[model samples]
Target: MLEIRNLDYRVEARPLFEGASARVSAGWKVGLIGRNGTGKSTLLRLIREEIAAPGKDSPIRLQNGARLGWVAQEVAPTDQTILDVVLEADAERHALMQEAETATDPDRIGDIHARLLDIDAWTAEARASEILMGLGFTTADLSRATREFSGGWRMRAAIAGALFAQPDLLLLDEPTNYLDLEGAAWLEGYLRRYPNTVLIVSHDREMLNRSVTHTMALEHRKLTITPGGYDDWLKLRAAKLAQLESQKSKQDKDRAHLQAFVDRFRAKASKARQAQSRIKMLEKMQEITVPIAERTLPFSFPEPETKLSPPLLEIEDAHLGYGPQAVILKNVRLRLDPDDRIAIIGTNGQGKTTLVKSIAERLPLLAGNRKVPKKVEIGYFSQDQLDELTEGDTVLEHVMRALPKDTPVAKQRAVAAQIGFSHEKVETKVEKLSGGEKVRLILGLIALAKPHILILDEPTSHLDIDSREALIYALNDFPGAVLLITHDVYLAEATADQLWLVKDGKVAPYAGDLADYRALVMSSDREKAGATKASADPAEDRRRNAQARDTAAPLKKKADAAEKSFEKANARIRTIDTELARSGLSPQKMTELSIERGKLEAEAAKAEEAWLMALEEYEAALKESAAS
Candidate 1:
């Protein structure tokens, strides 16, 4: 579906692609993977023709008449509903429907209708809804105005539109960054079954392993396409590297021997001619250029001076929600031991974050007790923690600020270096740092606290595969409790020995591994798709409609009530954010406001969870009623 030959590209004076050539066959799902800042997104832009490859000889070309689809940006806030936006993505279907409405001739109208049928236009809404749901949107959200959704939700809507369109060649860039575990799992399954060709740039290992048919490694300013998934590619790449190393070693030995012979015999008349010949041969020989290995830094977390007792942190009969009526998770009992390595998993809005925040002591319990040793310290890392960073400060400055005022400058620099920052990078301002660098800086700051427990939420979202592997290594080495919430199944599988699943408003031990959860997610998606297909029967459709009408009313009332509570809490949190942004607050005042904001966020989350649960209940009741 696509071909590139000798792609020579440069940004300013820096070379990104130098004679990089690769071909992607039709119907292949290719994962583009490399270290961060290697121009993966730039390659996508070139494919989309948004950026020029800059020569008549530029050879990045899609097959003739092939359509290229990518999400350029989040869907703009508009009055149009989500479903309408996605349905309109299918240009042919939309055009035909528009023509059918206005066509004067009976024959023309018939032709339009026939084309629509060929395109399955009648089921466009259902297909669009399914795509949106797979990306973690609700059925009710399909009817809501795009203006009502957040930027992330709108981005998912745009992705859904792209999938609904099903263009000949699809390009996705880190498509799972905004997704929760369930959504990511659903998307992985969807892409594995996608019919068209896809070129995706992702740091998600699980998706690359499960969704893509091929792995395209972008390294050394070139592309290497390998059949099969990431693991397959890794194995092949290892073999190739090993072969190169062997060749280089043999070549080096030969060169050394030839040089030694020339040096020893060049002055001897008997061997002078032979020495000259060897020297000429050595001069003519080409050096074996084995590619340098990519540098990956290890993550570091300081071991605590004292080991906390077992059950380092515990929440007993925790009612983590807004209040009695709006509890998202009730009677929840969880414990974190000094040596525990736990991963929290669930669908979005299912209380994973709520449980984590409660465990981190960022959220106050509505009606429960939290216990932790008075001396025990917890280091919490969340995406929001990045916002707390001082953008104007340097990496070294941030690290220095976290340390004792009396600490030596050498100690501060050493601390910064431990997080993979060089002396040059230490002086770079936080605002100029990339996402992964910012994550490292935050991790460094977290390490300085020497906490007994660590709670991380989606920590690997900005990290590349190597960095993620480094993180797994670090977590395994750290002598403290680790609680992680992430969509990256690879990281979870590597770092976490215990699994906690948040489902149906409760947090409990998961009985299976990551593979089992993956199967469950795929099975759920299949069942949903099958249910959607079953609606094709006219009698069944009519029966479902009548039953939905009967059961939806009471449930809708409950959902609306929950939504209102959520909105109220959410508005307050926004107001607090506004206030916090204002200048000239005392440190004491800031601390109080920050505390209040955390509690309010937890309240808002609980209310939102309650709302979602009510909505799901309503949908389930409608489906059950219809089936009966």
Candidate 2:
């Protein structure tokens, strides 16, 4: 559906990609993978035709009449209801349906028929609703205004909109960023069954493995399109790295042997020819340039001075939310010990952020008290770290401002260097810093603070894979108690020692390993999935139940009357059978029909059981309504 030929993209004379070519076939699911700043998003934009390349041939060329839909990495909500925005994806179908609805006259019927043929109106709404539900949006959620939702939920709605379009080609950038495990699984299932082409950029290994049939890697100013998943790509990468290492070793050995031969005969007149020959051979040899190893930041967090007692931080019956319309978490209790590295898990907009904010002292709890030990010093890292930095200050100035008054200048410089900021980079203004640089600066300050407790909210956001690994390593080694709020399950599994699961306005302490935690989350999602299926349409359920009750009431009356009539018929049949026995009539045919009627009566009993079960379920649902 899309093709790139001899594409070269550059910014300010620096080449992002050179001579890069890739072809995406119909129904292909491609995972666009690369290190940060290697232009994964840029390549996507190029394929999307949102950005133009500087060459005779355009960066991207699409097949004729191929439609494209994109889910951006960052989404902003418009002032529209979630339903209207998703419905807009199929406006033509909607219009056709409207026309068909109003087509009462025979003259207008022909026009409606043509419109239906053009729009495929009959099946469009079903398809749209299916896509939306698969992405974790319900019919009820559809009507909610977008402005009232958080950024994460708004992104989900945007994703729903993109999928509802059912384009010929779909481009998703980090689609799983704001999704829970259930949402991610649903997307995987949808993409697996998708008939169109797909290209996605994601850091999630499971997502890439499950959703992508091919892997497109960008490295060394080139694009390598391979036909396999992430594991296959990783194996290929390992083989390439091994080959490079072997070649480097052979070159080193050959150089050492040549040097030894030259040294043995350099000063001997008798063997001067051999020496000259070896020297000339060395000079003429093609130099093997070993690839430069990637650089990594080397900051290790300092150990905590002392461990806190049990209940590191506690909330007693906390009620946290905004204003009088607070979404209360009542009678909440949690205890964190010194060794606990807890992961806060929940769906988006389900008080995960509110709970974290209260713990971080960014918000005050309305009802309950939160306690922190006197000896514990807290280090908090939030999504707003970038905003915390002074606009006009340089990177070094920012770090220096966080340093203690008695701290030496040399020590401060060393700290900055450890976080990959050099003397020159440190002098660069904070306003000019990129996202990664800003994160590094904030981490540097946090490390300097060396608090006993660290609370980080989505700390891995905007960080490259290498940076994430480095942070994980540092946190693992740190002696402090860590409280993390993140969507990166892999990171949580690697670093957390405890898990706290929040759902349905309550929090539960989970005592399990990472695998178990995943299973629990999946199980909870399955239960919710069943509930979603049962209550797919609240309005429809109510209507059907009301109609069923109405029909059932009249049927019960008729059934009673039929039972009375059947009792009379049974008495008459018995009398006739007795008379027939005396009259020597066989009466076998009447007996057979009587037996058939009895079987029908048994079937009626079963139907009554089924009806009662349905009614009981309806009643139980009402009883549990308060909990939901």
Candidate 3:
């Protein structure tokens, strides 16, 4: 369904893709993987046509009439219900259903019904709901207003909409970054059964191994597609590299022999002709291309100098949550020794984060006592800690804060360098750092504490595969205790010796491995499905259908028009950017293109604003209709 030909792209003087080409057939799940900054996201933008190819001959194309879909930016906060937003994502279905509602002619009504059935319109709500549920939304969340949810939850809703749309080719970039272990597992199963073509960019090795049919590697400025999953790709790549090395060694030996022969025989008249022939042969020989060595950053978690005793940290019968009324987990008894390595697993909102926070001493216990030695130290890593980093401060400044005030400046710089920061990167401001860099900086700061216990929450979300492996090694080598909460099962399996499950308002040890946990999660899905089927009521459905007919149809039409206008302007802006980037353009032509791009950007912004206004009006009307 997608084909790329001679794709060559450069960011200023740096080349990201050179003569990279790949073809993806319909219905294949392909995983796009490489080290960070290898331009995976850039290739996706090129496919979406938001950024044009460098030349006409270097085209990224999709089959004619093929629908392309990705997770769009979160919608504007509105009174629109989550289900409505997902249903609206399938514009075709929405238009047909609207027409079906207003049609009067018998033949027209029959045609509309036929089309609706063809698209499975009758099951659209259930399908949307299922996707949302798998992504961590509760049953009651479906009818809740979008404004009521946090940004992360809204992002989940956006993901649900994309899945509900079911475009011919779906593009997902690190989809599991926002998901919990349960949600990630559900997504893995969903992608395996997805009917359309899917190309995902991810660093989750487990997902890549289990979900994709093919693995596409971007390396040495080229794209290579291999059959089978990530493990298969690794084996094939290893063999190919080894063979190339052997061939290069043999070629080098032959070249050296030829050179030696030419040097010795060129001065002798008897072998002069042979020497000339040997020189010609040497000149004609092609050099074997050796692949460049990949550089990966190492994670260093310094071991505590003083080993703390057993039960270094303990929470006894603690009720963990925000406050007395908001206790999320109760009767929890957990302890961390100096050498413990534990991984927490559960669905979102099941108190995984809550339990971790309580252990880290970030959250207060509503009831029961928490005890820790006065000399014991804990290093905590969380997404919130990343946000708490001072944006205006340099990396060095953050590291300095973590160290003692009397510590030497050279020692502070040494600590930063130990955690994989260069001299230049140490001076870089926090706001200028990339997501991965920010994560590294946080870890560096955490390393400064030399804590007896480390409590990490989703530490690998922004990390690449190599970096994650580095982390696993670091965690295993560290002398301190570790408590990790992450969706990356690979990391958990590699590092954690004990698995703790937080479910049903309690924390307990799980006897099974990750595979067993996956099975349990899948079985829960089946049970939830059975419950949903058993709970269906025809009377409630009729009432909802009757209410939906009263929604403001005209407002929706206006919103659709505005959305089209915004898309057109955005497309024009992309074309303008492509034109402006062309080489050897006249000054006058460049000026004109720049002016046009400015105008198109403004127009696109205006159109988007109008669309949002129209959408809000329609949502308000719909909410009132439903309430009535």
Candidate 4:
């Protein structure tokens, strides 16, 4: 539990929070959200006691003895192995182990051993391994040097270390940026059963929707608490905004009328009383302030020159990976239509980005042939593209450079504004901008090019909710094909018309949407846990077993759904084969039909895989239930 009263904070004489207050009950999972530069991170620091209130009277308190767990966003390069870093999270246990190792006296060694046993220090390594695996660490990666990893991946290890500590309060700031879809799913399930307070600051809507029980927003220089998940927050905010806007509109109109009357008849003796009465009425009325911003930049991609081209890019039995010896994704058969909005989803290191690169022709498809239309142009946006905006260049300079040399300065300024860069921000160097600002610049450049297709990899990873909403609006109106690889399920759902599941070295159309995928991941994790606890002791309490059983019930339903999907896919495959077998079909028609059959076969294979996985989980659940 946490509380703040009369809180005030500032940076260099600028007030970030003024007379703000907030409350978080014990056991609540609250999401802290606000636009970038609104002091979301700064507020977390204040709560963590890294910063002081402007006055001693201002209060920021947490429950006594509440342990705080926050991973450093920036971990300096170190020679420590990943597992070693996680295992060291438990300070007491680590100290006990050191004491036990060095103590020569029998009694001292015995005491150290007893203390270690009390803390279950023997399983510390295994527990660390579990957290690491949940965060997408492979067995081989456990012993790898932390310095060997990229900054994003090192942060994953840092996050794992926090989870390893098992503190009473876990504070995460944009923890999902480094996670793929699978790791994000694992985290959502982990948070569901978390027996502590959690305050995570994230822009991933799906994560907030699933993991948080409450929402805390820093807006208008005040910290406000709302009791609900992300979806509920949206509903509550929409209603509040509507009411506030309505009141503001009516009040403004009435004030205008009163002012108009006063202006017209203030000095005239005959109408003076009436005008004075109206003035008094207007003065006594309270002012209405709208809850949300009235201004939003509506950004859209430039119209593509070409239109209505089916099969814009196709890959035939391709294998994709870096260099020549490794193939991370194999046997890929895909086609891109003129208006296809395909979203690629999977866990980290599952080749989602690699597949995107192959399709974008940024990398060679190690094996098989790729056919891309000669006339097609692709606008690619990725984190690496940030490097292209050199340090000395300003946002306005980048936008104008992407345009024709003869482009007017006014037009350049308009583009900057269109992309959410303000007059002051336009002059800021690219290196000094926030991550979201850099992405906006890249998207602004992409928009200027008017490409026929857009390939975005985790485009919304660094953006706030407002910027994410803006990007969704843009993509919704974009009249071009989209190939998106993102863990931001919210943006994917809004922008994508089709989902491409990249997993287990295969890319295929998923049979369901984001919701179903989440459920599947949850059920699978539960079943795996159930199997390990299947050998229940006869004396185990009924309530604990019942709780476990309740969680496991969803596994059976998922299995049933998978079975139905498999049957449907098989039937579709047979029908496609029948169509291919038909006599007197035109050569071109047969060729098209063959392609359709291949797709159905792939879908059926995916369905078959899902059926096997579901069956495995259902059987494990049944065994655990029987044992209980």
Instruction: Provide the TM-score for each candidate, comma-separated.
Output: 0.84, 0.74, 0.85, 0.77
TM-score, predicted candidate 1 vs. hidden true structure: 0.84
Candidate maximizing TM-score: 3
Better of 1 and 4 by lDDT: 1
Q: Whole-model Cα lDDT per candidate?
A: 0.84, 0.71, 0.84, 0.78
**Clashing pairs in model 4?**
none
Predicted candidate 4 versus true structure: per-residue lDDT over 1-628, tens digit per residue: 7888888788997889888899988899999988888898888888787887777564888888888889866555687778888888878887887787788999998888888888788878767777787777654456555754557778888888888787888899898888877778788878878888999999888888888999988888998889878888889888989998898998889899889999999999999999999989988999888765745455679888767467788899998875343456889999988789988877566678778877888677788998887888888987766755654568889888887999999988987988789888899999899898888888878887788889999888778887789889888788888988877878888988788888777999998988887677657743453233222442343344345446556764676687688788768767766776788889998888778866766776666556544544443343344344
What TM-score does prediction 3 earn?
A: 0.85
- lDDT tens readout by residue for model 2, 1-628: 8888888888787889989888889999999887778899888888777888886668688989998888754335556666667666665666666777777898788877877776666555556555555566654454445653445667887788788777898999878766765567668777888889998887776677777999998887788888888778989888888888888789889888988988998999998999899889889877766456677675466876776667678888877654333444556677666677989876543567667767777667777889988877777887666665755568777777787777788877776787789888878988788777787788778877677778888887667666777888888988878889876666787888787877666777867765675566456754454345335575765555445434344433444455455455546555544554565445786576557655645544444433433332332232223234
Q: Write the per-residue lDDT of candidate 1 for residues 303-410, one digit (tens) a residue.
A: 997776798877888888543434568899988888999999887766787678777866679877888899998989988666557645799899988999998999
Candidate 1 pairs with clashing backbones:
none
lDDT of 4: 0.78
Name the lDDT of candidate 3.
0.84
Please give the distance, in angstroms, between residue 373's alpha carbon in candidate 1 and its true position after superposition. 1.1
Instruction: Give one clash count per candidate, in the order shown.
Output: 0, 0, 0, 0
State the displacement of the C-alpha of residue 225, model 3, in Å, after optimal TM-score superposition: 0.2
Global local distance difference test of model 2: 0.71
Q: For residues 287-401, could you state the per-residue lDDT of candidate 3 as single tens digits? A: 9987978988888888887877798988888887654434568899988887788999887767787788778776668899999999898899987666666645798898888
Off by over 4 Å in 2: 72-79, 91-139, 180-182, 251-290, 406-411, 511-628
Error in Å for residue 224 of model 3? 0.5
